[model samples]
Target: MSDLSGSERRKLEKLLGMGSGYVLNFSDRTFGDFFDEYRVEIDNEQYKTGGTSKANRMRTFWTVANNHVLGRVIEGLIEYANEEQCFGDSNPSLVTNCQNIAKRLLSDQPVAELDALTAISDDYDFEIVANHVREAIDKNQPEAALDRLHTFVNKLVRITCERYNIEITVDKPLNSVFGEYVKKLREDGHLESAMTDRILRTSISVLEAFNDVRNNKSLAHDNPILNYEESLLIFNHVAASIRFIKKLEASIKTKSATALDKTKDTKNDDFIPF
Candidate 1:
């Protein structure tokens, strides 16, 4: 029997302690092979340690510690697998560490970048996006506001789909979700018919674009950059589609003004109908 590696022994101890009354067994040579790689990183002897944390000294030690711990977590999982170590002892704990990393990664936040977060708060939270929409509405720029809203909704849908690795070319499902969001705004009085035409037009465009993508057809016949690009075709389209909100508001204001004018004219004509 050869000697056991440090991480291998660490994993064994963890499994034995966690499994407690349960049966536990693993070969030492296999365990050593499992941890051979990460154990090197634990010592920082491989000359590769951290990514974002090491690059920027501003990152807190806690963040650095979290990432450094991941090296062991990786080693632990490897050892667990090699030893056929049942009981789910090491994995569940190590997975928690991986889950934490995944959660933070999704934030699109870098510990070194403070100013970057202000612009990208929306990338993480829709509530932040909603607050921005509220400000645009308060500014009486509902058209500009809806355009922003459309962009937000479209991106939300696309991201959700892409994260699942579904076909991005087939966007109707995503559009369908945003359509519901738009209808919600309409029901809440955030949108009206003057806007409906434009919304419908955009919806049709999205549907059309989706068809084009699915059928290998296109109006422009060439892909655009961002919203106008070869990629992000739908994202860019949704962003551009909100321009009709202005016309919706304008049409309403015009109709109301005309109605008021007609009433004043009748009063001046002495049309009391007596």
Candidate 2:
């Protein structure tokens, strides 16, 4: 349903395969109508793609998009089936149990492979997010940026873990930060009740989602030069965000200072009117 390119489809399939590694067969059955989707190339995907289909132009894109979706579906089905049987035919209700099993099965990945994968993850996928961040910050269009905010938060959380080499944990208290934000806004005269509320809500929701995902897998303690570069990126982004928030706070305080000055001047003039 979502716009998926040929390469994006491939990555999703890979994720499903890893998540459902216990399944015996992931792709034997036909990918039904629900799974079949055509891949279309937008302008940006052009840079990521290789040369054009010089031979059999009609069939080239059709195969790339159509087949990619079908293959991904089959792979996802395999993962679903594997997840169903993951706990030795019993339901994996306890989080620890599932985590333990996943760790046992997957924790032994080669250092080089992990290094490569994390490097891949570090390359920011700025698809919808580029526009969202731009619009949100520019016109203060929170509604339009909600979807991108979700992605940005996840990216932030992951980068945090990557840089700090610490486990990411999302507890109830930390999760309530967004809720607390809305309450603060309502109590303060700084923001409008509606628009400010939406922005705060979207920002927090994205953060909560980030917290949920950041700890799903642990990174090895060691990283290559490229990994170090990724961590640097994480550091830079985090610092920038913190700086931006502080600047906004200072701007608000500046406005308050100006208001106080104006009020004092008006009162003095009123009292001394000749």
**Model 1 misplacement above 4 A:** 1-127, 130-202, 205-232, 271-274
For 1-274, candidate 2 gives per-residue lDDT tens digits of 2233455434333433333321223232222222232222322233224433221221233244323233343344445556666335433343334333333323332221112111113355743454454433333223333334445544544443343244444543333544554455456654655875666566565456544333331121122212323333333343354344345455767998999999999898889546
Model 1 poorest 10 in a row by lDDT: 53-62
TM value for model 2:
0.28
TM-score of each: 0.23, 0.28
* C-alpha lDDT (0 to 100) for residue 148 of candidate 1: 41
**Pairs clashing in candidate 1?**
223-230, 224-228, 224-229, 224-230, 225-228, 225-229, 227-236
lDDT (Cα) of model 2: 0.39
- lDDT of candidates 1 onward, in order: 0.42, 0.39
| Candidate 2 runs further than 4 Å off | 1-172, 193-196, 217-251, 266-274
What does the lDDT read for residue 204 in candidate 1?
Answer: 48
